[model samples]
Target: MVIKAQALAYFVVKCTFSGPQDLTLDEQLIRTPGIWKLFVDGSVAGKKCGAGLILSSPEGFEICQAIIFDFPLTNNETEYEVLLAGMKLARSLEAKHLRAFSNSMLVVKHFSGEYEQMDPQTTAYATKIKDASLSFGTFELSQIGRENNGWADALSRLASAKTQSLTGSIYLTEAKTPSIEKKECLEIRQGADWMTPLRNYLEKDILPPNRREELKIKYRASRSIIINGRMYHRSFSQPLLRCLNTEEQYQALEAVHEGICGEHLAGWSLAFKILRQGFFWPTLKVDASEYAKKCVQCQLFATVPRQPPEEMTSVLSPIQFAMWAVDIVGVLPTSTKQARYCIIAIDYMTKWVEARPLSAITEEAAKKFFIEQIILRFGIPKICISNNGTQFNGNKFRKFLHHFGFK
Candidate 1:
């Protein structure tokens, strides 16, 4: 005889922990190396109940999971459900060491023994966790909030009663929004190619009975032939070319170029590689070259050809105080109503630069600055060059420069 779900939940909680808010854990120990990680979060609204679990290897990310619960459960009970299931999952995977995280402070505190066992159900849950931990290499469970936990939060919401997360299905949709593009995964079905009929006719004694058409097919099939159900293109200089369907060809190309044991070959190398492996398709050479062209990883790591686009060309300044290059820098941080923009002038020969800050960059202010900083201090320049900004290009600033006889 089994008790009601609520009664069982209450009993488990009562056994494992007291209803006090004072439960807490000490500073977490240093995380063990090569330990697998598990993230679990539970959701309960009205009477609906659900849990989410994400397990990951030390090197790879996001090990997939499948979980479902029908019984009525509180948020804490649901959390316990997730925790137990996750731990069992870790054990089943033969994971030697494990670390689990949850958003439930009560569950983390109670299970970690920072709180007293006042509820039997809680006590039961905590006891189970202790027993389960010994089966793995090393196990630790800690608490985290929803902050910076977008994936776990989204997965949790998806598991609730109002929503169902189908595998690889879109969960949330905003109406009238543009759909996102997705990558295509290639798969090939057996007997879905031109060579299938030839293979069947030659190997399994299957044939269409139109004598004339059949004879033609047999004659053409002889030069580029099917032997023992494997299609091969006859070659005079080298070995026969074995045929592959879409998926097999893709995998073969990957193995040749970028597989775990691949050499990351160039286009011609890749084409020759498939031939050396005795695999063939009509577009084998073209496909290998195209694959190398479209390979994102190879493109990212490949050496870029580098050379100067044109011959060296630079204007040499004749003398000091003859020419000045002028520019303005910033709308920088404002302080005590001080200026934010700095007007800068560089002497072409001496490499000396003079700067003055102004609250505003304007034609009038720039004229005044030129008179004080350039005209009076450094004498007149043969050429005053500046970028075509409003302050430099305006008719008034040009007239001011003309008044100072600056070219």
Candidate 2:
């Protein structure tokens, strides 16, 4: 067998302060008549500080040296992540017929079929360890009491000492701490300039001369420039401005402007130039109506229905959380005692009803009720059903749901 197994052997999983030299003498004993299992351990002490590990066979064949780092302000959860990272490295080395040992009862127990309440980070690490074990083909992990784990403890202390040495400079300097916000601010500013070249390209004459003149006329008329057969106007003003030299840019601008002769040219072209450079057309969510609306000929010829068809009316689904029915029952009489109206939310599943009384049947009052009363009580339903009531149709309510995590 490529891997020899001894019937009886001493397997010591130890945490120690003794360096690799301590294992040199024990090398052959580990490979002697019987087999030996060895585990070494250590822990980190400070910021960027970490523990270390040196695993050798019982007879002292070198296995691995691993480092475990810690952040001063971190919790057990973050420490667990560092531990898992260590295990993942070991697994990648393809250790087989192996045993794992740790001073961390939480880590050892959770890994060895012990069910203890673990934070999400630990839980995630445990899952990964199990997955790693399976990928390694065969392995066993066991926990040993500290008394039986002396060598590993010493090694953990050594690792802490090493970490202290490495991070010693950090202790002396106030500027050693990295700035997280500085990188973000740099990225934002750099991103703005990154688009500058693109803006110049657009302003420099990307548009055909004919299109530019058409756009100029549209600017004068305060209208959109729609080319020969397209629904959306291809903006030419900003494209024209990006091509301008510094003198042209300095003479005038609000994105676009009216000439002395009242002829329109690119004014706020500078802003438009930037915009054109950084332009990213959002992916439009298309409904059948939107496509039809965009068709100029169809839009002009299509007749509006006298009233919306009953079938076209949105109906709340039968599933409770699947959809919600909302409507403002209004035209309430103005009275101090009686509320002017109410916004009602009906659950499609439970058929439960929630109502918010409104003073003036105003959109604001209806919205406040929907948020404070309906959403707060029942949670945000996947879909909301509301009639063509002014309150429901207002832009505010749509923006509210969008701002929240809902979708």
Candidate 3:
């Protein structure tokens, strides 16, 4: 027979005539009770931070969570966050034993209790890790090669590169709250700003009892109101602007002149834009001016050349459906009823065209056309564009827009 000349070769998974002796690594893992395998990774690129975690149970079940951090973070800090998040996830799963793996040697050593955390930030992270680990009956942290950590590493890179957020096992988290420090929420007490007294009286109706102060508060508060716990500054010229608290004011300042959508606008334009966005802060003009001075991009990139007075000026629309251009066509040959001009309205973005035929193109006809065709049909727009035609520039049209909360 062909088998007569062959010699047997024994391997780990091979069975002998006596019995099965040795087991493969996979078989050994399956025999372990309640053991969960965890892999975690983190990355920071272009001032963005992301973390990824993968957990495998003894039954070969795998789950994942991909995290994206809005604020800046270092690689080690991100790694710690991933590890802590993974442990918490494991505890939630009722895992009593865990074998965690990571490519970060620093994290592995910290968790193994072989290294001291010298950095104050790292100390807090290590403490949290240690505290989270106590729930497990047995826990082991070790470092593996990057190749073996492909899932988590790839997940971290994916989260970092994602332009938009996704749902289900992936989340975009904003960590603007203070790190490694305990701070209280901003509270607006009296004398914080000029509007403090006005706020106290308007919301709480708790006016100071001095005769002069009470009169001043009453007069100033007549223009303000509380809507959904937010104080507002109202005007006949624009929509009601929600006054910002101290923390929110800082966020608005940063978002306006330097945040992602910021083009570093000038002080007046910046203040007006913030108000136009339906936000108001005390000392808006002064704050915007101060913040603009510190913007390096604006100092280097901004150059507003003066334009001719009547050279078809262009104003940028703030957002979608916020601006509309209206103009009158020529006084055409009279139809059956002598209808002359047509008032045409078009949205700046969507190009949705609307037109109204007019008998005389008088101010009254224009007003009725606007109220019916534009406001009732679509919605109120922030700005209405028109030339110096008396039909549009008349005082009545101005009052029409003002009463409708147009900007």
Candidate 4:
């Protein structure tokens, strides 16, 4: 009976009803080979902030790391920092499949795309996390209860603690700056150009092998001198002007044309200003002209030309009263009959003028004045021109024009 029970227990242990599809996500992941689990937690005590991370491999081996922040950061930022640290550690280990857990709901939600990140700092952190996630074949982040994340929570609190009384082995790290802040390094390369030959010839007495080029450099070097390691061109009537390279030419033009105390002068004026400031380039005038033209502010606020582009021609009426210009001049001081507006008509060729006063400038008043003062008195005009006022452009005025056969 004892041997039968042992065989039955062995058979039960070997048999499984649940297939891979029926297994929970965590169970499936646990059974997968080469998968890694990450748990991260962040803590803030008083003014200090810190984070803790725990990474476990499929074989059940674990690595723990603690981060002490030297800079001030909020709890949410700390959570993101710890997560990012975990991701870096996994990537360094070449872990292909990663599953991360965080006790902070905000961090998880932001990473999972369930919540919008409104804070600029956190948004930057999220973008960095997303970019880093692409390094792994499979990456998952889920929210867990703080109680369930006890080991990471304890490690985080330990990081914030002043004294560590109990510890075996943990990688303690210090973060001097926020991860989201980027440090930019700019490399300036001064390549060979027109100034390079002159500089080489002047500084080291180096000259080209060609006889013609050698003679040209020798002749040009006569007027150019080196002062404090800088080449300068000798001016007959002015101080020595510093010769500039391609980059320096651009800088000089920008400073003179649009820098602080810049007057936004024209192209030629800009080149002269730079020359007055003791700088010279071969294409200074041309470059200055192009740069000034390209300036958005200069183009936008440029003065408009007052004169017409083409030759001026006078418009002549073939006969008197054939062409008339009608206009309204208004809002004057009250005069007799409480008239505060005046409607006037003029003959284009004869310079004849007729005027009428109006209490209100309206379509009806304009029609009556035009009919009695100009049309009936002088006959219907072949052409009439007026400012685009409602009284002139209204439907009633248009119908009156159509009825009179006026263009």
In terms of TM-score, which candidate is strongest? 4
lDDT of each: 0.68, 0.46, 0.72, 0.78
The residue pairs in collision within model 4 are: none
Worst 10 residues of 2 by lDDT: 165-174
Give lDDT tens digits, candidate 2, residues 307-380.
75655855556656557777877667766767787778777877888876677776677668867877777677
Q: Candidate 3 at residue 229, lDDT? A: 42
* Candidate 4 deviant stretches above 4 angstroms: 1-28, 170-172, 182-407
Model 1 spans with C-alpha error above 4 angstroms: 1-32, 161-407
**Model 1 quality (TM-score):** 0.34
lDDT of 2 at 13: 32
Q: Which candidate should be chosen as best, given lDDT against the real structure?
A: 4
Counted clashes in each candidate structure: 20, 33, 0, 0
lDDT of 1 by residue, 178-265 (tens): 1110111211355476566667666776777899868866764675775433578776667878788888889899888987688888
Q: What does candidate 4's lDDT look like per residue over 72-155, in tens digits?
A: 889999999989989988886778899898989998889889998899989999998998898898998988777767767765
Under the 3 Å rule for N, CA and C atoms, how many clashes does model 1 have? Answer: 20
Query: Candidate 4 local accuracy as lDDT?
Result: 0.78
Clashes by residue pair, model 3 = none
Rank by TM-score (best first):
4, 3, 1, 2
